[model samples]
Target chain A: MGLNLDYKAELDNIIRDHIDMEGPLLPVLHAVMARFSHIPKDAIPIIARKLNLSSAEVSGVVSFYHDFKKEKVGRHKVQICRSEACQAMGSRELEVHAKKSLKVDFGESTNDDLIFLEPVYCLGNCACSPSVRIDDEIHARVTPSGFDKLISDLRSVNHHKARNS
Target chain B: MRKLFIPNDTSAVAMGSNLVANRFEELIKNKSLDIQIIRNGSRGMFWLEPLVEFESDFKRFGFQSVDLSEVESILEFICDDSFDAALNKHPKFLGETESIEYFKKQQRLSFFRSGLGDPLCIDHYSSLEGFTGLKKALEMQPQQIVDEVKNSGLRGRGGAAFPTGIKWQTVLDTAHSKKYIVCNADEGDSGTFADRLLMESDPYQLIEGMIIAGLAVNANQGYIYLRSEYPFAHATLNTAISRCYAEGILGQNVLGKKICFELEVRLGAGAYICGEETSLLESLEGKRGLVRSKPPLPAIEGLFGCPTVVNNVLTLGAISTILCKGSDYYKNYGTGRSRGTLPVQLSGNIKRGGLIEIPFGISLREIVEDFGGGTFSGNPVKAIQVGGPLGAFVDRDKWDTPMDYEAFSAINSMIGHGGIVVFDDQINMFDQARFAMEFCAIESCGKCTPCRIGSTRGLEVLDKISSKKDVEDNLILLEELCDTMEHSSLCAMGGMTPFPVKSAVELYKEDFT
Candidate 1:
């Protein structure tokens, strides 16, 4: 069941911590994603073996959920809420501007890997429609220009970090 | 020495409270002022957020949108001798926290302690009548507890409007040694913030209510399936749950009584369907959030194929008040079967968008006009969606309709989660209807054909209609698709996606043309 040597210890501990619980697949999967930022395909066989579920069963749960990404996301995940509330506030226009500025679609990341654009159903800030969540922080009342400026800020930060490195 | 408060509620954070809180703390230290800043949950008044409130002689007064540069000035003003006069003159100052007309008008039964105190502090919570409901429940028998709820006429605020007592009674009557109480906190509804507010502002209230529910249903284990989008609520709830355990309110022999209840929180993975109780249970079990077929309702066979009482956040949050105030007191508020206060969330293109907890019989016009202050765009509100994404697109003519389950149901609409999303005249109903289909297509679990396929087809038809490609024929086809999806779907996810589409076409007939 060995796939790769990377994160083997973290994967084993995650499996050990949750393997005893009923319906342990999702918890173990969340833990793996938390550590790796995205669920590694190699870890699936190890989880499947430990949980005694088939590899397909484990991967099925992972792929079914939007939160579980197969690859690493950008440094900052920018999620624009696309629900009806936001749509009423011109979120469709915001989305177009966001994608064009970021040079990425809803689930894609930038070439520089500075920003990842994602679509969220609702952040429960419908009062401030056209809301955007950068990492865990929410930015409200965002127009197309506001979104572009936000992207510029994120890119500048990434540029500074890259320069330092 | 004085105390100040800043909201850590997600909405407030969105409006720059995090920076405000940081800057205020730094300025207080730099100026050597004897002031403490507490990051509290939002007061549900969003328009004037990053609202900084300070305690002066036991009466709290506040300033709205406290900026980084203004922190020092506000600190000096608060530390001044004529604080009251200064507050009166300050344009941003909202005289008294409790006396604001917006906060004063509404009856805040479920949200009694929200945005008023440190959510994690047990002392502050208890002082605000937090555990009064649980204390009463601790003394009563299980059936008596259920009976009290039954008499209160509290229905599920999660949009189903099912009687809360009957759902509890089913789990109570069911013979199972290991039953569970699961709270559905996965509030994905576009206009809903009531659940998020309660969870973040007063986490212990939900904990107390869940503990009371556990006592009522004879269940010792409880799980709250919270949405992943609400990271603030997640952290707050976890801390509050730990506090409950440490305070002897949640472990074996709760408060030295024979009751033992252990609480846990599971996160939903960004799926709208998980808001459905059956799908919530599925997600709680660490699986795909696919809606389970009913008849074996979540009450009969829920989480892990055992008897489980699944209640929404507001439903459980209301338990404490119901227990403390008696069922009759709660039943006295609203009209007919829809008893008690409904936390109606007014949002989306709204001037005064926030959580309004009122009696169920309040008219849509009053909520949208009087309380909401009309559209933010200054245009006439063309349509108001009373429920969530799946709710009907109600026209302006229906403004005077009483927002009750029955009244709304009669008009092909629902008070689903009591969230009203206002759309101004600039909105195109046809486009909105198309979005309803597209959203369903994107979020549907792909378990059923009606929701999975029908939603996509619905979008295509809407596109055809919008482009004027055989408009008459496309309209007929779209209507037929809506009917098929409504009738043939496996769950409400499939069944209700057609609601917005059909209602739009019906009410704004000109939009389609």
Candidate 2:
């Protein structure tokens, strides 16, 4: 009950802050996604109500964009660039290596819910191809070995925190 | 005391600039060094980053690809009595930043101040002639400003080569209580980072350009619709914008004048269609980024149904130079109607790849071989995709074609957003052609049937051709599909999706068979 109330309070603050801005929907949705990692299903109606929009309109926006997540994602979200520039520099091979190592295809989370893999069109790092973004940090010139190191680093850091707690 | 410049640009940071900077700080402190480390923007030299530039006797020289291992030795070189000579003997030394042959052979007007000083420093910006354009624009009338832009021959750098002066003139002529200057910073091209570079490096230049645009169009408000993929640019622009506001460059009083111009940066959801003007406006209005039809062009009715002048980031960036140095100065560069330098992005399977800003008439071969230094894999170059995904793939035969807007259009290709993605001979053109169709299908806004359904169908037909079961029939069907999408689609998303596919089939038919 306490967690639910806290979540609701947070959602209300996000809607209230962005409601007065010009075209407040994307901003409100972006804020919600940033805070929650994914737009909570219940937050949609609340956002629509504050912005004088329909739930359907709000939901349509969430579905239309690839950034707005429908459900909870893993702790570490990995996006591999699948665009032509990255492909030209062996992104296809990188993508294959990533999926195999993660033991999951694009848009799937591992059974441990630690790593989620998705294919992003472009991250604007084309100058250094075969780019990968783990959460917010972008890694460039990423080979199979480089990817393995990145994943291991993430796991080790998280494991260290978990053990400390 | 000498200053050490390290790039905080996204590409530089991604290549571990932060790690090098941290190590350098530790090394400098331990050695009790008098050098200052400034986190500047990238010089568009990706291969040589994290490039560390040291100031010695009023000249800036760089050391390429500096990592943690070289941090201590670099500090020693910085502390050396004969700094320039010691740095020259250092294995990773790159002479002077501007005198490098790759950077020396080009024209850099819009990107004049990039990688020079701290991007966020207002004092540094002013010293480099940052707001001179705005000062000139303030002295001129609205019509005069528009006329100057028109005379400069500046076109929309986003994709369409539409004259910018005419668009501003339309907005200025149209009387409305509310007007807008929308800077299309939604740079979604796969092999392009010019917009990101400008925003991240010389951010105040973009802000100054937007201010000039707002003043010219009599629009008191401006919005930069930036893509979410560019988190670095978003943060840089926001910080630069806040700095502008604090310094009285933005908000109610424009540089203490009675005029008022406000600016804000709006983020785009992960939709490539939002790069389109109308779609960008729709997305800005907090709705699905569906493409709006023409007849009421964006110049007449744009964001929130008001008269708006939507210009690409580079086009707006050029406005400052044109206003400060005069239209004739800008018009002196480039050949034919495309008068000005274009910042061409060299990326994807290329050696020495980075940003190349040059006049329009430079050939593709000059760009790929001379500047880019050929493929990274050392393989024979198979094909090159000029522009973005919607751009055509040019074969070896077309390498000599001059890279102006007119020359490219004559060959069913375009220098769209000035992005050049190279592919080695190892790449399968059949797969590339299929990927273009698939990309369209994935990104189409579903507003038009031709782009939405046609893309999926086109992908399926390509897959069928790949299977070799009904190859001849599928090839004919693909051509028809390409024709339909080219003519019937609402916007470039649908209309130009066939460019890569058609060009691939024409140039590399062996891959298809």
Candidate 3:
């Protein structure tokens, strides 16, 4: 794939502006990913070259963390809590429901490129039980039905945004 | 003007604080009450979240779990200054949070500022004695600051009790101009909510602690590797950071000095292994939270191969208090080397499943029987896990063990992040042990041979033992494998996963046999 020069420059500025001075290679990587949505496979070489580190070193750090995505991510990400606390609150059932409704398992995105579903540990909302985060917004006490409604709402919102754009 | 504090923490919101907040707004509009509602963080009394605090003179009256349906009565009752029996704030229902034996026994150093101020407001944080530690650290030489922490005997609160001062001094002594301070806020441990609670309740305290650490170690940049689970905490912390920057508490010569420290929050995709410091560092770099071999240790060459100081949320949170109160004040609380109050999280099958801060040396019996009020199901207590999923299980026979670091270690149990999980008599020990191995197998980063393969093998052994397939031989093999993992694993993932399994087998051998 052809690299977008402007996008790469913006990515470079984000790394330089937010994370260049930090010693550990990971925070810079996190900053880059946070800015660009996903860690581009091509950018790994650039990062390795900038930090005077080996490709293995950069790739080691990248592969060790579950958060870094090599491929493109959907605009909205949905993470369901699969930790013990959430499990005790029936997250297992909720997970099945969410998967069925989203038509994707954990770590997989829908064909529409709208929502990406994944499993998370505890979100510290145990009291509410079965918490799910739609992008940055955490929704608690989420039933399978509630998750379906949320997905529908997100789909509609995305559809609306697409029309506007 | 009538001032009200509605804690906007997840626990409070879970208990319907958002509904109560909206109701309060509606009541003000309809009744024209001269009241301003401010959403703050939880006060650690999680059981009583949606806790509405109304200011009267200097004292604040609290109402626990106030829902929208009861807001009218609550507002009316508060306005009249009459104790409403229905609203549960009457003298009969008003349980004094401070006077409650659970709250009374806690020293509350790290959690001192939590729930006492608006985390979003810098003025409130300042009024409540926030940033005083950063100011004190800024005035002294970095070495002197490090010396003070060393003397205070503060250890990492993230399971492993490594001394914070030693780590800082090592990083400081290391010849590196480019050092980084990474705060591990990936509190994925099931029962441990202290890190999350501190982050959501008192964001500025953590920031102050990080800034102080940065100033002490001469590092200009810091990152809080928070879990994706805590969206509210992430949002609140970001707001707190913005407010700090606006108020000159962070970034560019903080407090009119030449010390420049910038902080950012990095979210981890929900992986349990990321709680490990090295794995956390790896994840912060946008990698999977797989463990790395030690020897270089994060202090000498960490982050991007420069010297770095990686600490747990509670360990750093305790710094501000130690700096403010002095080492002597902090040292006077806990027993022996475990000298400080520990913010113990009481969870699982307990009547009072909430956060409690207590001085060290307190017996597990007091916490379990006295404070916890036994199991919520009213059954006899069978086994209690003092740490996280990986922590060992202590049966009723060993309930008298003191909660100090040495005491737990003496009994072959470590106070891993002070997460106390209670299990009633109805719980099956074999099932629990099986679950522990299963949890390890599922969450293991699959980096090393011992953890990746050993955990799966361990689970199979546990299954055989539980299912009575050559139960005795399987039990022996399980112990042997646990020993190998404990000695040879790269990190605590395999090292500590055996804690629950071994302890369960040792404590409840009958279940396995």
Candidate 4:
């Protein structure tokens, strides 16, 4: 988040570390995303040149994968399992509830850019069903109300942080 | 002072294990009770999650699904100490862990350590005969180790049911100076969580298995190609690996032996097709997760063109057990070709949904009704998908069929990754069939036209049929398209997509037309 628009040096360092790898494009792109939550638009050409690939090739690789984001997203990323396993357990209702609670659809962030909702296939917790991933932690068997509580907890954590700061 | 064992497994956590853990900790501290709480892996009885077990008469006594609200009352009886009979009187108490009927029926050879102890702690793992496999492996010749696995009949648990030892043998005999062992942890299966459970709950077993695999194939380096979705598994595995390295079970010289084995976890960027070995190899190489045509097979040319041995987490996870427990012990359980225990995951609308490690030859009826306790909603069961997304759908008549690779294959289906997803009578088989095609279209690597074009076309046909636009003709065309995809696709992603679609149509044609 601290990095600016000119992240060429940071980008090069990531590319350099993985360029010697057999197929370096994916790893390098992964590294960039790991460092900065989303890969910046400008980093594509830089990655392409280092990997000796065209900008289109680099962009295609990034866009093909669902994990990669083309642009910035909200601070607190919320993902609901959209796979059949969760769907069988009424995740369709959970998804609708999450969207309404966040006041944002699947790809949209909140007005204050606090929470972003996305659909993930399976969180590998099929038994619990209706799983939700808030940032890096996955919560299982989530209901619409349960999802609301988690969001409220996140908002309150931020509220407390702001007041203290 | 008493000890309590509560699961910190992913599914357990999802079912309010954390809240219960926190509450238990706070209550014990407030009461100044000297009770120790251990966050063990799930017992695989998900319906009884947040399940708490305490030491009583030198055995672990149980409390099934202890909610956070009941943490105080449960602690109240426990804080009095002396293994109180009053605490045992709690309604949730299931007497002892060993007495539970669901766990009693399981043939827990490979999963012996899972859901029983702390995964991250070396002591927790070692306390339960952990490094004995690796320790035994270090003394035996590489061929001996391979023979042990071969004798045990451990097939790849990553859905293919390929002989894991044979895959190891090919790499062992390849005569390459540099070889690699890769654990395909991509687990994209909709209903499967056994791999995730093993990796997260008892990661050391997988690490131990990989180290043994490295030793068997004469390979020094290993990689676990994990999917990005399982952040918890990734974190647990990484931590466990670091712990293993510190414990001297891994790194430059395993257990102070001259042989060296190192392991790393590589994250796969959201691609379901990457579960295929070559695609996983491609993804690991930092390329697009595209399926590669097999000629040289991955055991010959894999992972930067090295002679690589790729096995699923379950396959590798079984290695340590086979070596430690002896091959015959492992072989004694399973029936026919599907030897050794299968950690079958019961999920999706199941009542007592969890992991059940039964030997081969168990009937679907036994698994679904007996172990799983039937549908969660108490609704009548309709169809059950025996594998992942690409696996076939079985109608009600087939519930009596045994679960094994050979048996499933006999019915034009396979127990892919050993995940059985239950669907209630409320399900629309037509939509499920359409979903199979849609899933394939979304995940097709575009390297082959049969999978890529056929999938999209299949979806179109299904849409037309669902809309009642010449339904009879559309079904015939869909059947033809499915045949084309099954015969012509480069990999299982395309080839096997027809299994679910065709099975759905055959079983529930009335629902469609």
Candidate 5:
């Protein structure tokens, strides 16, 4: 499939603005991934050529870090804290609940392209326990029922925004 | 007019301050009481958050976890001083936070204004001795500023106990016109929350410290590379920066001086390795949070090819205090070479899981038994991890070791981020050791070979040892791999992963063999 023009422009700008012009190809690739929702597979060669790095080197860097993604993500990304602090606060159960509710495993996007689920380390809100972030908004002390409500609410909001647009 | 400061921190809100705040506002409107309520950050008495402080005759009276339903009663008591025992809405623990032993024992240099002043307001910070350091720093040469910090003996609280003054001096000496100050706020250590508390409670202190660093180092721009996990902190810090800019605490010619200092918060996507300085820089530059090879240390060439002084949040937070209170005053608290108070975060299977700032040289025994009040499991304490997941697991036999950097290092352990996690007899040392390697394997940035593959191999060897498959052979192999990783890895994630694994194996040989 052809790349989205706006998305490509935005990604290029992010790469140019954030990543270094030379040396250490991994960080640049990582930066690209961080800016764009995902690292477009086609951009790998472009990034490699800019950094004077091998395509294998770029791919190696991209695949090494778990946070890097190769494909586009959903509109809303839900990251659940699976670190020890959250684990102590029953995140294991919450993780299971999230998987069942979302009908996808960690690092997987929903079929509807609404929400993508991922595992995060400590959110620094350990005192509250079981913290989850939906894009920029962090929710704490999330129960299974609360998780369901949160996902549904987010989905509905996404739908509303979609319709509005 | 009575001035009241109600903490708006999440910890405070979790303890039900939002409802209380609304009620206080309602009562003021209803009674037409001459009162102004300012929502500030908490004062570290986490158990007593939703802490309401009422200023009377320049003295602040505190009420913890004040319920909204009790607001009217509290107002009546405050207004009348009537002997309505039932109506007196005092917290479970009454009196000023300073009087509490948990707080009183702490010297609180770094966290001096935290939980006491409005984090987002520069006025509150200035009123509480914030910019005094920046003013002092600007008056002197960069070398003088560096000398003062060196005299204070303040070490990097970001795991490595390298002297802060030396680092600053090195960065100063390094020739680069476009120098940068990067504050490592990606505090992902499981047992640590000092950075988070500082960010949420007293963000201005961090800003002031950064401004001072910028002025001293002749840097124009800075970035606080905070973890994406801390959404609240991100918002709080952003608010603080805007306020600082408006108040001339940040931006060009800060405090009407020729010095120019600007700060921005860069959020790192979920990556534990970013806690490492090089990895943090990489992440800040919008790359994967991967470790970078040293020799061109961040001080010489860092953050988009500039001389950047990358410091831990606490290390920078402590700088303002050192400058404000004088190096001698700051250094007088701790023993040995480890000067000044350290904000030790007590967490994980401990009764009192919170932040406590105590003088260096305080024994781990005091922290575990006295401050922590022992393990939360109520079982006898067996082993405790002094640092984060990467730190060593010290058996109770070594509990008397002083919390100073020298002492911890002497005991084959480094106080990485001052995170102490207690574990009872129920904890299996073998399993804990395995978990450490597993954690490293999972979080390694894969920049270096030893860290990337060695961690996974270490885990496999640990599995062999744990399963008792030629346990002796596996144990030797584990040690060999740990040594290789320790000597070869680019960053501490690989260097220190061996600490817990090796320490666990050494301390509790019976568990593995």
Candidate 6:
């Protein structure tokens, strides 16, 4: 986990890039999170100082949103739609299956750190109910078997990469 | 060379449209055939997505729900000597995509170019009378532009039925050198995807609309507050925005008119309340999305305390149509006070789910049964939750009511964002009521007491009713709590949550017992 990265220099660059924009804090945090899997604790004070806000205010915003993760998550983030449309198409069962198959509940990463499951409200693909987003790709009409195949395929790819390395 | 159209829209991609498109590319490569594959936006017939269309001789025919196996057969069918004979022989053939009963019935105004060709192609957009609206707007005065929208009778399509022209007029009249035009692209309502569809399918339409709005209000800056859930729309918008800058459609000289306007997309951090204008502004400022009070409306002092013209994606998207084809042409389509077309999204356990851009005043029954084609499970239609989560769970008796603002209000329901989520006979009304309260609690923003705390109490009361513990008293307490939230809560999040709960209890009394 120790990569000997320069946190202060990277934070300064992220803050500097977005500082001129109208609403710079969210974009800065988003850029930071994109660079580092999560918003590191030390980066908050730096962001607050750069944006001319207090540390409490910065952390308040970071804590308010569900998207801004404070800690690192699994390599692949898997989101399941739990909104009414998905529920109408039997996503409750899919949710149950996802949890059972992944061996973890919502907001928890798998023991192997392969996948992180989270309950998303909606993905705007209501027409194709029971939608799931794995990494960046969203899959519609996801059944238990469909989800299993996706996870297994992801795992197999990871395994192949590990073996080759 | 014949062209093959496959949708690259979110819904289509979810249904394996990408794989189908890639497979076609591979097959064309292997066979050395003279074919073109165009990734267009969805036609909104989502149930038949991955809908492959072949265009030859200026006619477009479709193949519904095309998987890898069907792709091979489609290639064979298109290569036949005669299209009619080949289409007749094929099992998946859906004759002329435009003539399909679902697409034909819809009166498309804003979505005219959807699924026609590449959404990003400026030439394709131009061929279909795309920037004609902005061209028309350039010659007119600010008041003239505002008057045209007012005459069109276009209301805020993002749930509130407030007139769009009036909102713009307020911003235009307000003395501010640095006003802003914010497009609310946060389409968080569960049963809705219209905003997403407009942004993804006809992005230029939205860009054109924003530019028109900027011209109308004399505002030079705009921001599209997009939700994090819509990654696809985000990508499409960034591409479109940059393209506009490169093409001289946006920036210091818009369309070479010496007018200046700049637009940028700001992403929301998974907060449903941000769909509310005030919350959206707060989020744009890089703060927690807390709702601001109303006395100073967004049009007067918004986005860093400057006058802002905040309109929904569809509301702004409609501006292009209103400007392009005079207000009279746009106004002639719908009934009563609700003039112009509404992009209605039909979803959730529906047999034929998609986007139906029809005029207002059509009954819920028509939209749910006629356009939706009833339940996906082939079960009896028991309940329909029109207008997203805050909307009421209307029963069969209420389905006949016309789907306009006043008519729905008369029946204790609302056409919020035009999202209709259907449920079959198997749905439990009581459970839905509980879920409504739970959702409200989770997304309240914690600025007010009723929404923040009352939703939790409402959930507990419903739980007590479920457990059969003094049901009558608990029901009375629940009604009182709903009354408090309705009367005093900060915004619609708490104010209108009672709409669904009260309607469900009143309509389905048996479920309560």
Which numbered prediction scores highest in DockQ against the true structure?
A: 6
RMSD of each: 1.7, 1.3, 3.9, 2.1, 4.1, 1.2
Off by over 4 Å in 1: A1-3, A160-165
Worst 10 residues of 6 chain A by lDDT: A1-10
Badly placed stretches (over 4 Å) of model 2 are A1-3
Looking at candidate 3, what is the lDDT of residue B275? 84
Cα lDDT listed for each candidate: 0.88, 0.91, 0.80, 0.86, 0.79, 0.92
Which scores better on DockQ, 4 or 6? 6
Chain B TM-score for the candidates in order? 0.97, 0.99, 0.96, 0.98, 0.92, 0.99
What TM-score does candidate 5 get on C-alpha atoms?
Answer: 0.86
Clashes of each: 0, 0, 14, 0, 6, 0
Clashes (candidate 3): 14
For model 1 chain B, where is the 10-residue window of minimal lDDT? B84-93
lDDT of model 1 at residue B1?
75
* Tens digits of per-residue lDDT for model 6, B64-176: 99989888888988988776776877888888889998899989998888888899989899999999999999999999999999999999999998999999999999998
Model 6 per-residue lDDT at B338? 91
For all predicted structures, in order, the TM-scores are 0.97, 0.99, 0.86, 0.96, 0.86, 0.98
> Residue by residue across B1-513, what tens digits does model 5's lDDT show?
878888876556655677788989988999899889988877766645667878766767777667777687678767764523532345443655577677777777777777776778776788988788888988899888889999999989888888999889988998777999999998988767889889998998888889888877878899998876777798999998998888787888788988888788876656789888988887666566777878788998899979999999999998899899899998898889888888888765566556788898889999878887876658887787878888888766778998988898888887889887677676677877887788888888877999999999998998877777998888888889999999999888898899888988888888887
Give the per-residue lDDT digits (tens) of candidate 1, residues B1-513. Answer: 789999888889888899998988888888888888887878898877888899987988989877777787787788889876775666677778888888888998988777887878899998988788899999999999999999999999899999999999999999988889999999998989999999999988889889999999889999998999998889989999988888899899798998899998888888889998888888888778888888898788999999999999999988889998899999999998899999999998889888888888889999989988989989988889989999998866778999899999998899999899998999989988988899899889989998999999999999999998999999999999999999999888889988989989988989999
Quote the lDDT for B397 in model 1.
78
Ranking by DockQ: 6, 2, 1, 4, 3, 5
- Pairs clashing in candidate 4? none
* Model 4 TM: 0.96
Residue clash pairs of candidate 6: none
TM-score of chain A of 3: 0.91
Q: How do the residues B85-136 of candidate 2 rate in per-residue lDDT, one tens digit apiece?
A: 6777888888888799999998899887888889999999999888999999
Interface RMSD of the predictions, in order shown? 1.1, 0.8, 3.6, 1.5, 4.3, 0.7
Model 4 Cα lDDT, one tens digit per residue, B65-144 = 88877888787766664546676677786887877999999988777777777888887788888888988988888899
**Between candidates 5 and 6, which one is better according to lDDT?**
6
State what share of the real interface contacts each candidate retains: 0.70, 0.78, 0.34, 0.66, 0.18, 0.80
